[model samples]
Target: MKITGDHQLIKKINKYLVLDTIRRQFPISRADISARTGLNKATVSALVNELIESSFASETGLGESSGGRKPVMLLFNERAGFAIGVDLGVNYMLAMITDLSGAVVKKKRIDIAELEAGALTDKLKKTIRGLMPHVPASPYGVIGIGIGVPGLVDDQGSVLSAPNLGWTDVPLQSILAEEFGVDVVIDNEANAGALGEKEFGAGRDVSNLLYISVGMGIGAGIILNDTLYRGFSGFSGEVGHMALAQDGPLCGCGNRGCWETFASEKALLVNARAAYDDAADADAAAPNLDTLLSLARQGDPEARRLFADTGRWLGTGIANLVNVFNPELIVIGNRMSLASAWIGEAVYETLDSRSLAFHRSRASVAYSQLGHSSAALGAASMAIQRFFSTMKATWE
Candidate 1:
């Protein structure tokens, strides 16, 4: 026996297909959409009409014709809606607004030395509230808010644990939704970085890759077969907590010898401060990542060596991942990327020597192209994705 379906489901599916086709290949004609989607011309036309009527698609001038009247070109109205994305770091908050096409319209960064949950939430609310008015009066206004936190985010958007930030069991999504009266999405920052690169940066062409976010801490975003692979518990990308040394520096996760303990921005600063103090420079200002980076840029041997040491540690972890995953590419992102100039050689050197010959040869590592905006833009993309999902012609 065969099953029958209602027209609503079919209509929703078909309309989504048409919209997706146009979104991907804009300046597209309805005739081409009909051919590509295997839907008849009339169905394609009807769907296109729906999208245009809903302000999702708009007609441009005529296109080149094939033995008939010039077909009108259709354009996806990216500016019809706007989305807000936030990248909440251990010490900073990066927020931005983007069109549906993921082009950033505005961005701001605020630094917070401490991560008290109340203060953090208040700041988050304020940042988003400030951004809402700048949304350019689109059809959906500020459609939704997407946040990337450096922690384990469950399906319900509760941040289970972010040790570095001292956060746990925070219902971030619900809190934001209730406060702002809009949809909210929260995910691991590394995962957001991976999505950012896949959608707009270096990893766009690769299906299997890893995004390593080396910031105040470290994490990995695994993309397998063009999909973000959140593990069985949505905690897959906590690569920073991976044990590297049997006895090394204590990590924020209360573990010794974790990869981030050696390779993260926090580690770099710790080492920098210690080294400076050892030199008996009591009058020296606290050395931060930016100071060390500037010193390295100015050819300070000590600063460069510090970065090299960190790079070597980063490479060791990456090599392990390369052997295990054999991904097509590995994108090193986040704060560590800022030191790529100083650390590039050491990372390459370690990977070359340590990683399995086959895996190392197959996989290539590079820094984030979007720099600090990777997670923020990616979060925005998630909000944009949800906006479209909720508007898929679900009619009565």
Candidate 2:
């Protein structure tokens, strides 16, 4: 007896396959796609025609042919739609707009003051409203919104808790989706950063990588075999709370000796202020990351030492992660990436000395290639992924 396949599912999958193929290898002919994906020429032709009709793919002219008439070449219509991605930090928010292909078209960053849940929601609404008009006239016009928050988020797109933001159980996803009338995605900033790196930055070349976002706090985004590992309950990457010393500085999470208290940007500032206070230095006009970075650039010994110490601690935590995960690459991202010149050597030295030689031998470390844009871009990519998965290309 013969069996029948689900025609709609098969068509969706085939269309998606053809779209993805064009996106990756555009200026390609349908024959090439048939060869690459092993779909029949007629099926590929039908799917490509449908994609062209949907404005997702376009003919770019004829291609060079060996004998017969030149075949028409195609290009993925990246500008056919746009997406919004937001990286919400404790003190700042960076919003960006990217085409379907993940190329940033516009971005804006605003400093955030202390605000409660209600006020924060209002602020986010305003920000989203502000970005909507600049989305560039496209077919899908802001297909969706993706946000990376520096906290825990449930699978439902709600921000479970953002301690630094003083937010807990905020139904941010629903709020945004309702307000904007578009799909919304919410995830931990570290996870977003990791995804961002994996998709478009340094980790693109490696299958297993760890993206560590070090800002006011430190959190990790684990990628195992090219996939983001969110862990049980969608609340992993809280490496900040990893205890380092039996007795160390108290963290806001009600724990002492947490990794962030010793290695994060907050840690650097805290130590900087203390050092300046101890020395009675007149330059203690409130040292933030910028000030410390300037001091280091000016060859301040104390600043150098402070950065070195932070790097050493960062290395210690990373060494522990390396031994456990054995990832091919560890990307240090977020606010701390700005201090790469000052802290890189120290981090490498410490990681080398602390990690097991066998594990250390295969793993390499690098700073974020996307710089501050990692989370935002990654968030946009998440939105894009959801869009594709739900857009008739998936069962949903």
Candidate 3:
């Protein structure tokens, strides 16, 4: 994979290389970008000028030179454009607007009482409309919209199935694109969460990582060689549906003994309700997740036991991932991660008992640094990446 001969292609690649160098090392001189990318000074200057004209980069104050005259520093212009990112959960939707650098400019969340596709789409459109007016004037106003759905999505952005939302064969990307007149990118929430963590959270330094989103259900996002590993048909990383028992509890995906049935937030809540029902003094009503977490933090024995059980189950699934993927890091996120203090212990203990010594030793488990915002932030980052790639194409 050497890029040979095509002069235009070479120039395009060099332009992106220089842009990336400047992005990573901001307020840097053209000479430094040339030095870092091994591109000649003249080429670097040309690319820098193009970037400035395109409003992608800006010239800041001059920097002290080692020998001759001071050099003008270049900065990646984050406000050149904006992107919208949405995390569509089963019961709620989180949306955020961000600049090219992924810094969130505005954010909103709406709770959904109905799961119908039409209703959800309506809410989504309304939210986008509200955000649109706030976007500042730029070269590419609202360059794109990226969405993370809790379901199986295809390469073309069709949501194949979102069982929790009762959606099937939903053309979310096309719908949004037609409605808003902007490019829309869609992916599974877990995959988006993985990207979010990789770009801004716990997995930032690692090339091989796994992000497990454990909310109402569980799903995993896999990253290999610092790239998302979407398998054939873009349907990989559905770890929640992996069978763990032959005759266990039924799962929403029409399977029994699925991993999520035993380890997800839904599972934890079910277990908590059962525990409450068993106690003589227990109230008839079930406690919410926050209340349950509070009880556990207060040393409620039953809550502790339930979380421990879920943690062990979570660890069992993670062990399988470790043995198969050999990831350098595993990040646990979504609502369930609030119990990581207990779940983490059980995960480690289970890995120690069940996982291969070599495989388990190489991987470290961590909680998500971005918490609930991971998916939305990741979606925005995806849009930003797409915008830059499109910009590169025009350069050629």
Candidate 4:
């Protein structure tokens, strides 16, 4: 028993160190790995061999020689084990299969109406199973599944409430675990997107960054000091529902003039449609926002005006965020940023006019490079973190 325990402990410790080192600095040679991890050369070589055998890592040609023969470089196997990441939103369900490196191997998207948990969970289960074949078959199997939900999620992976989804206290994680037979993680979509950006996108280098997901609603993911800051109850970043106006439009969160009511896609579309209908000009005849943006792209005056107006409103919200968080970068995501060329300019203008001078100069608002995939990619990252943390725990 003692021998087996010691063997397992050492094995886990080696796997933990190897995976950790590779994650931070991949495409590294075995000798470099030894130096960084303080593992002896033979131990590093043995661990590298084990990782390669287990399909968790692979050789990536050779590195520049120091003194000895050109050493083979090692990297985390992006094609090794897979994880499923799902962004379940009010309008769509985006599912992606990713490898240990959080690179999307396959993606699936489905449009679904906002509904109760029972029906939604059923559909989600089918969607997840449908995506499994897309992930490359591997010995480790799909490590687990992570979900970026559109509402408040408790620490226990319960959907405390998803007003958009008409859910309250839904055990989404347990339901998914039961259906998929794997570990499940649930977090707010915006928070997940923030993690995605911080880990793999534009905010990677920033110590403080804010990811604002402007979809059907508004929410933010905040990274402070290079770590995700989930406030007490994991609800710290609920900035979208922050009241921006005392008597603004009625919000889904039972508030008036919430930030999202002014800045979200629904808000932009709503106001744009209103502006289009109210305009006495000839170009205001069209009421649809998508059509308006299309016309704006073609130089329609009314369309341009509508986008600019909405962009100003969005900028107001962003300015408030800037004042509060003082993040180094603010990433705008979701469908609205598609019109970044027009709206982005307007956002900059509003911020320039409204925010404190210091913040305006320090922070740059940019479109999300990950596009709509930020949430799913972030979910995959959660799985990767889980995998590494588990390995570390086993070692400890």
lDDT tens readout by residue for model 1, 1-396: 123346677888898989989998999999999988999999999888888988999999999989999999999999998999999999899999999999989999999886978889999999888987788987768888899999999999999999989998999999999999998999999999999999999999999999999999999989999999988877898999999998999898898999999999999999888888877653563678888888888898878999999999999999999999999999999988999999999999999998999888889898999999999988998988888788874442
In the range 282-328, model 4's lDDT, one tens digit per residue, is 37455554676697899987677767877888889889889988889
Question: Which regions of candidate 4 are displaced past 4 Å?
Answer: 1-14, 38-43, 276-289
CA lDDT scores, all candidates in order: 0.91, 0.91, 0.90, 0.84
- lDDT of the structure predicted as candidate 2: 0.91
Q: By lDDT, highest first, what's the ranking?
A: 1, 2, 3, 4
In candidate 2, how many Å is residue 74 off? 1.0
Query: Better model by lDDT, 2 or 3?
Result: 2
Reference-based TM-score of each model: 0.97, 0.96, 0.95, 0.90
The deviation in Å at residue 187 for candidate 3 is 0.4
Over the stretch 1-396, how does candidate 3's per-residue lDDT look in tens digits?
A: 355547878899899998888877898999899889899999999989998998889999999898989999999998889999998987778999999888889999987778899988999999989999888888878999999999999888999998778899999999999999988999999999999999989998999999999988899999999999999878999999999999999999998999999998888888888888879867743656787788889898878888899999999999998999998999999888888887889988997788789988888989999989889999998988888888788885
Please state the error at residue 228 of candidate 1 in Å.
0.6
Q: How many backbone collisions does model 1 have?
A: 0
Off by over 4 Å in 3: 1-5
Which segments of candidate 1 are over 4 A away from where they belong?
A: 1-5, 280-282
lDDT of 2 by residue, 207-319 (tens): 99999999999999999988899887889999999999989998878889999999999899898888888786746646788888988999989889999999999999999
Highest TM-score, which number? Answer: 1
